[model samples]
Target chain A: MRHRLKDVAERAGVSVKTVSNVVNGYVHVRPDTRARVEEAIAELNYRPNLSARNLRKGRTGVIALAVPELDIPYFAELARHVVTAAGVHGWTVLVDQTGGGPEQERVAASGIGDHMIDGLIFSPLALTADDLTGLDGIPMVLLGERVDHGPADHVAVDNVAAAREVTAHLIGLGRRRIAAIGAQRTPEGASARLRLEGYRAALAAAGIGYDESLVAPASAWHRADGAAAMRQLLASGARPDAVFCFNDTLALGALRALHEARLRVPEDVAVAGFDDIEDGRFSVPTLSTVSPDKEAIARLAVELLAGRLAGERAAPARELSAPYRLELRESTEGPADA
Target chain B: MRHRLKDVAERAGVSVKTVSNVVNGYVHVRPDTRARVEEAIAELNYRPNLSARNLRKGRTGVIALAVPELDIPYFAELARHVVTAAGVHGWTVLVDQTGGGPEQERVAASGIGDHMIDGLIFSPLALTADDLTGLDGIPMVLLGERVDHGPADHVAVDNVAAAREVTAHLIGLGRRRIAAIGAQRTPEGASARLRLEGYRAALAAAGIGYDESLVAPASAWHRADGAAAMRQLLASGARPDAVFCFNDTLALGALRALHEARLRVPEDVAVAGFDDIEDGRFSVPTLSTVSPDKEAIARLAVELLAGRLAGERAAPARELSAPYRLELRESTEGPADA
Candidate 1:
């Protein structure tokens, strides 16, 4: 599965130095020769060892933090924590946005273009276990939802438990009709699937039958998607007394829609969300949500990566769990008689 | 004023190879020699030629983006655009947060640890002209407020004009007692000063005397500071009919304070902000802001940096201006008869 430079050269019918020139972006290679070499690289799934080339000479003391997107406040806040944590190790972090797509996520996981980083801390959105099969020579620590076992160290919050707790909090408020936003219809929605399962478990525990109509699916977890999903649920006349969004951004969007519809928060509908981003703290009604220990996640991820980079290839992969707590705010605190 | 490796060696009373080892982070260098070399490096401000070392061998196809903080939505959004722009040039962007401090900004400007990047697009907060004097070998494009002339290519919106337009809009809404938030009382506050000047010019043009009490200073442009500044203004009994925030986050924070005080937006106080971030779009009553062409800024900055890296160093540094427009949402659309 591991293809070397010589293998690429043999397949392209060119010298190793020619393939090297193409990989290194040297302009002297002929167009046809470069095309042939690139085709061979694609067919063989060859990842050039440029990252290792720098590592072998000396420590670059630079690590890469690859996230789904920087525009998401959660990722932005998480990136800040990671940068601060990495600074303590005397390592500079280079932040890369993978765009949460398979192609970009795969490129980040493969360490394709980051030839200067000593290791990578990657939070993948669509990369699968099969895609991670031959991660040849990079020290990687995974963050967020688990894709598979035995590949890399992972640091994440207990999403299922946190979701269950949030749903239970809504149920305890005597709300029989509850809505769940941010359900994904794809297999790559591992995080969404887990949260949905927790919501179902909470409803079943409360002896309430699950209503399919109350579960809204979102293609992406952005404010626009959340608003559209909320509008769709309302148009369907589900009339849910409480809404539990998968993240804070969705909750904020829902709040905007409710305000537009002239519905009072907590009095008519109690709304809750996960991932207590900073915006939630200052939102009009002050959103209630789950607050994962982002600092712990960042620190543990960097520590695990440092261990792997310090020649701990023989050590077993670690799956570290970060702590989280529910933040009960004005948005979720309904009247006792409701 | 440029110091070389030989200069550092001579100052440290050591060989150039030893200085090189110390600069390259080799662990074999003795503690005393390393300390002496570090002292000499600091005393002479010797920036190692590591970034150039990789550039001479071959293009690394990587550029670094140094911003103050990623937690700020504006910078995060700008970084996303820059990454997308760099991808078009077949270059990967390495994002670095300079923390808006002199030491960190100086380090980022000097290109000390980013040896793999061929260029840097830096938006410095506290760095001054003297700090940028001996930027010897790195190719850099400056963003945000102008720090010095003839040093680097600059890309930014006309901060003063944008601020004036926003203030004039508030004035046109028949708001006589207009307050300005985010006035910095520091020499490093170039952006803030420009915005303040624009606000003053707008007031002067309207024949309205500038009230010193209406200008509130925020140490930092975060939501917390905005909320605090608004609170201080309210407590000081400066009942302004309008508030113009320097940025969107501060405006969002001021909105929170207004809501807590039960003041209906536009009816009680018309609010305006700069930087049309996504959060402002979804905020209740929706914010009226100045929308700078961020895409154009990103593209122009990357193009300028690419040009410099392509051996256009002798070319005169150019200053490019992006366009902007006023976004008038419900927050600024007060009752016409009032």
Candidate 2:
């Protein structure tokens, strides 16, 4: 049964007005009556209605992080940093998993939870720039899987540049015939396109034409997908001297395939990955990969969202790319160093 | 500036009563007046105040997942399952990182966000059963650390039984002088104690006297702490033929230390860890671990919270334990198999 103001008033032996005054923190109530009303409220577990007051105040002190999913290590780690950053700014985080689908992404962007959230950090995977026309007035910042931007704030690393840098690193290690792993036939907002472009740019810079046969297609960018792609590449008789996986998850999978095949990394077949996940550090031969500053991206995105929520508008929209670095580890560090 | 209802009413050229009726979906408003009010609302980007409605209805349609932090892989994975399970029950999750401290855990449990959340799924690292006394009125489910039940739902795996099973497996593998890694002096709950007890039970069952020197203490459960503890165990010259880490993170770190020390696993020493995290599956030499049914726990906890929200009073408190299994892989597969 729901407890009402009348019930609390009856319990306190006072009128409903007295209970209301006490619950609302009004100073005009008599001291003994106030104490009685407080006792009654506590006994009833009656919470003060904060809706009208919150509506008047116009801030909920809660922000939301809408990611593809929490199971993915990259997004999981990114969410950790985002939650921490939001906490520093006195905001809590509501986490939503959109399953990386266009329909789910639209629902997340439709302000369904706007009543309790001050802003949103949306990372759309399946939605394109054209699909985001309805997100006009939401105070949201975009992360990961770069799309053509709407009027919202966006933060991401330069994927093309990072891929090029990692490819160059492989080239500098005297690795030609580098097989491109994790190539998706259908692109999501130019992410795969930019990475592929960077890989091609590096190959062109080294005077090696892109080999269509060496480009292994993957069903997904997970570890299993990387492993499958490597196996497919091996079966096709490409015999690439090196493999450049799209992400660390794929690279880790490739490393497992290499380990299984008794092929020594860097010595026989050099390998590299993108996104320096924690697993990359703990792999057998620690992974050599690109380390995009994830924490910096989270901080910048949260700060940008906070500013927009506070009605600070320097520009109608802002595009900030987080810095990236090529991290050298044992995976690509050849036998000479050992 | 905050958009006021008066501004919306003025823009719609209607009395505040008509605008309020339109906003509240009251049928007393005419069709043209309703359309005009909605247009003004769209112009103002006005969100219906859910706080007042939620207060009256006594349901927020939101739940909270209060974990220590999402950086840890086990917690991250567990949270993923929880969010999915909650979604199946039509509840959204508001994730809060309690920083693994008693103070923060208390705040998370004290109904601080009760006005906006229907319940909480808390994974406390520092709070004990005694500390959770006053959280009776709130709908919550405790995960991981086994604090005494305080009228809240709880779900966990039997840590003691699983630990014993793994230790017995190590003993069955023809290894003696088994050293324990990742023992915490200050236990969060029966989790560490039960695991340690299980290890001791296995040794006792095998008629091996408890050797204090073989037990290594880790201050925290991270990989670094495990590696440091392993190094300390090595420096002490215990010379154990096998090691059982409290969790996979510690085991991975211990594996790194064992690798650096030139110990070929299962040949020089065998290693086993708890919690079959994803990284454990793809480690250089695949890790052997105890796989707790995380999804089952998530489903049960979410169902329990939903039932509580709907006022199903079949039980005031429920305690459930998910099943676990021992997963064997290359880490302890031995040279004979090789």
Candidate 3:
């Protein structure tokens, strides 16, 4: 049998309003009264049926997070951090995969206004800035590219800066023949474009001319694509002394391809990547990566959303950047006998 | 300005109830009326708010999945699969990490009834049969370690059988003095116990005396823990010709330790693990292990939970065993000299 608020109120010898106030965590309630109400609630096993409570307040204490895909190590790691961050706020996280498509991203963005959840944290793959016009009313914290600067709060590392830093690190070791892998041909290629720009900047800063022939094509930011891109780069006669991949998954795939080709890492080809995933730490040759503070991004996004949900939206759309560091490992420890 | 259902109803030239019927996906509405209502909805950009609708039906079209920790690759991969499976049923998945503690596990299980969600799919790390008592009222599907049959439907791989097969595979390769890592010391370690039992079963079948000295203790099922266990085994003067880790994380850790000790894999000591995580597929030696059909497990858990949410409580709680296979890779590819 289900217990009601009235039953708890009766058992606690308090008004129903008082019990409700205690349940809602109102500060006006006396500590003793709150204790008594909680005791009664425990005695009767009365859980506040969140759906009914949310119906009255239009706040479900849950948030939707739509990412390109969780199967990807970066997204999976991001989702893990987001879930941890949401837990601190006593909020649940509803995860959806957009399959990196505009239609699904739209559905995910629109879901905030349509679903029972409080807000959304979206990391779009295919959705453009214009695609976000209709999603203006929702409480959203955009992750990944700042394709548009309209209404949503944004959290991300300085992609261009981080990429530049990684490329510069490789260049410092006298590696000029650097091939960039995982280049996407879409508006969603915001990461690719920014990272490539950073790579070009580093090359320019070092007075090295940019080489377009070294750019490898990728259907998506995945391991298989990275491997294919590496194979193509190998076959195209564009022999690069170093490979800088967009993400860790791509870099790992490239490493696998190099291993199959009987090339010793950092001896024949130095390697570097972004999004320092766990696998990078455990990989055979380890991995050198631009370690973006993913947990920071997740925490900041949740905190920003919480602030907005608490009706404290008083900014020109609050934006925060995650800190990043260059982690050097065996993969890019420089050429052997240096 | 936000559009309302009433505005759409007026534009469609229909009563609010007729428009509501069409919005709720009721099939009784005439085709033309349905078309008119849909057209009006599209024109006005009216979105149905799910909170109000869920208040009427007590279903939020969202389910909670509580796992030990999403930071673990196995659980993260499992969460991805669960999200995909939930999508097929037009349901959303809210994930919670329990930190693999008894208190956290209890909180996650209780969340199903207290939150604005339908049902729960739980992978408990520190919960026992006794701990799952009050959770019976909430619709739940249990995963991992069949310690007891309880009231909830369960889904998991046949841990005992799978462990036996993997161990038998090692024995067939002329490996003796096999060591086992990640033997949990808590009652919550049902998976550990079942797998250990299967290990003992295999040894008995192979006419090899069970060696208790080879059983190393691990505080948790992690890479670091596995590494520590392997180190302890090495220091204890227990020379094992083969190592069977409880999970991939542990196996990877063991491999790292072995690498540090300059032990050639398969030549010095062949290694195997459970849970064919993606990392295992790409690890240096390409870990040999028991590959449980994780996608199938996730699909079955979602299907089981869907059935309960759909009010289909039938004959005695249905329990299923996930498909398993022994994937022999470079780790157990036999002695390199051979």
Q: Return the top candidate by lDDT.
A: 1
lDDT of 3 by residue, B125-209 (tens): 7777667865544678898884358667888888999999999988988998999998876776788899999999999999999
Rate residue B321 of model 3 by lDDT: 82
Residues A279-301, model 3: lDDT tens digits: 77767677899999988899778
Candidate 3 residue pairs in backbone clash: none
Candidate achieving the largest DockQ: 1
Which candidate order results from sorting by lDDT in descending order? 1, 3, 2
Evaluated against the true structure, the overall lDDT of model 1 is 0.82
Of the two candidates 2 and 3, the one with more favorable DockQ, higher being better, is 2
Candidate 1 residues B253-295, lDDT tens each? 9998888788999889999999889898788878999999898
lDDT of 1 at B111: 71
lDDT of 2 at B35: 66
Q: Which has the higher TM-score value, candidate number 1 or candidate number 3?
A: 1
- Candidate 1, residues A289-323, lDDT tens digits: the string is 98999988997787678667656767777888999
DockQ of each: 0.49, 0.38, 0.27
Candidate 1 interface RMSD to the true structure:
1.1
lDDT of each: 0.82, 0.77, 0.79
Q: Quick one: ranking by DockQ, best first? A: 1, 2, 3
Q: Comparing to the true complex, what docking class would candidate 3 get?
A: acceptable
True contacts kept of each: 0.72, 0.61, 0.36
- Name model 1 segments beyond 4 Å from true: A1-57, A112-115, A146-150, A334-338, B1-57, B112-114, B146-150, B334-338
